[model samples]
Target: MNNTNTVPLVAILRGVLPQDVLAHIEVLIAAGFTTVEIPLNSPDWQTSIAMAIARFGDRIQIGAGTVTSANDVAILSQMKCSFILTPNTDPAVIKAAREAGMQTCIGCHTASEAFVAIQHGANALKIFPAGELGSGYIRALKAVLPKHIPLYAVGGITPANLAEYLRAGCVGAGLGGDLYRAGQSPEQTANQARAFKQAWDACQKR
Candidate 1:
């Protein structure tokens, strides 16, 4: 979400705990990722986001995912979150975030939704259920959308199929259940982080 034109690679931390979020933050940096998202649906997510910001606010871009209402954006803004991500495009929240000066990644499934997100001033577009749409589907959408708009592939992106998606023209990806498993220990989180980073690294070699 920076001006470097570097694609956004979001590490979706869905089940991480308040105590263990920092540990995975280290893993994410080690694994060549610098963007992190904590979904509000996760238990104690506010604590996790606050703690993460306290530690990695300087180096990493911290965001709140599954944001629905303007209130969620306001809460996350209070937590010092640098970005806001939603599972679906909502103009009200988008307007609030835009006014609050926070970067946003709005989720969309169809061309109409994608366009609406862009019209709402989203910083990036997340193609949810990208697996169902397939990597090739991006080209089809690209044909009709703005060329400068960055596209992130989320949902079903994993270490196993990351290269396929990246090679197909996805600027970046969001890993959900594939990155952070529920009740995982710090060691396990690091392992998964390494695996995903390795996969992304492999894509770079191409």
Candidate 2:
């Protein structure tokens, strides 16, 4: 997996159409986002991912999210997708992805789930519903997690609250609705990406 330290915001493009995926990716890349995921529930999601990897795979990391089944792992691996982001931790899925040589970012809320994911070879951990869990949750969780493990706070994150989670010890955050909404224009995506990138930059200065 690409280092999250360079560009800590992971832009999640949910419900993005195949036709517009590349445009959004182009702007995100220009705005300094090197990592992005198109959740599988989106329309023709696999096609969008394929197009993204074909175009910008060399420039940035491209992957899918909301993955639940090991069944999909083979398909994604065939596409040479760089990573998989699951909303919940499933040891079988984690092992399958790792065996396929794809990076796995498994979501977990509590310590038990987090440890389970780690043991299954997760490349990173995503704290879902992070806004509700609060940065305090991450702070407490970080205390016990392996120092080398990366924690990403996903859900209800915005440029305004982005830094708070980072300060709480998140390596980065997964940006969803705040970054892109279905039918949003590429220009709008560019603006949103710039705002988040600026937020991350400002956080690094503190």
Candidate 3:
């Protein structure tokens, strides 16, 4: 939602504890990642988000993922979160978020869902479980989607295969476990983040 076309990588910290979240985020920031999401399903996720925002709001865009309800959107809006990402297309949620002046990246698997999400005011489309659908699937979807609609590939995304998704027309990606594991040291996570950044930079160069 934050003009991801310029910096397309979203670091997803699904299981990070609030106590360690800031450190993890710092590592990601050091590696040049400007967007991060903490899934609502994680333990004390809200606290983690609030802490991140309080500490680094000006430096990076913090967001919440796995959002399902309009209430969730309202909470994020109050927090001034940068964006909301869902694993499925929910018009109500998307509308609520947009009305609250928040950016949304709704999930969609098929062309129909993609169209519906766009109609509902989604800022971008997240091609979820993208590893299973593959880049070919994305290319097919792109044939019907508006050229300006940003498409982000999530789930099973790795630095090695990210280029394929980009070539297939994905504007960006949401990197999860491949970028961070709950127990990994900050240095280890930073190394992974840097590797992905390098891959994305190389892909852009081409």
Question: Tens-digit lDDT track for model 2 on 42-73?
Answer: 99998999999999998888989999999998
How large is the C-alpha RMSD of every model relative to the true structure? 1.6, 1.1, 1.2
The runs of at least 3 residues in candidate 3 whose Cα sits more than 4 Å from the true structure, single-residue gaps closed, are 2-6
Residue by residue across 82-154, what tens digits does model 1's lDDT show?
9987899898989999988899989999999999999989988889899889988876886788877888899
lDDT to native, each model: 0.85, 0.92, 0.92
Where does candidate 2 have its weakest 10-residue lDDT segment? 1-10
Give the poorly placed runs of model 1, Cα more than 4 Å off.
3-7
| lDDT of each residue in 162-188, candidate 3, tens digit only | 999999999899999899888888998
The TM-scores of all predictions, comma-separated, are 0.93, 0.97, 0.97
Q: Count the backbone clashes (under 3 Å) in each candidate.
A: 0, 0, 0
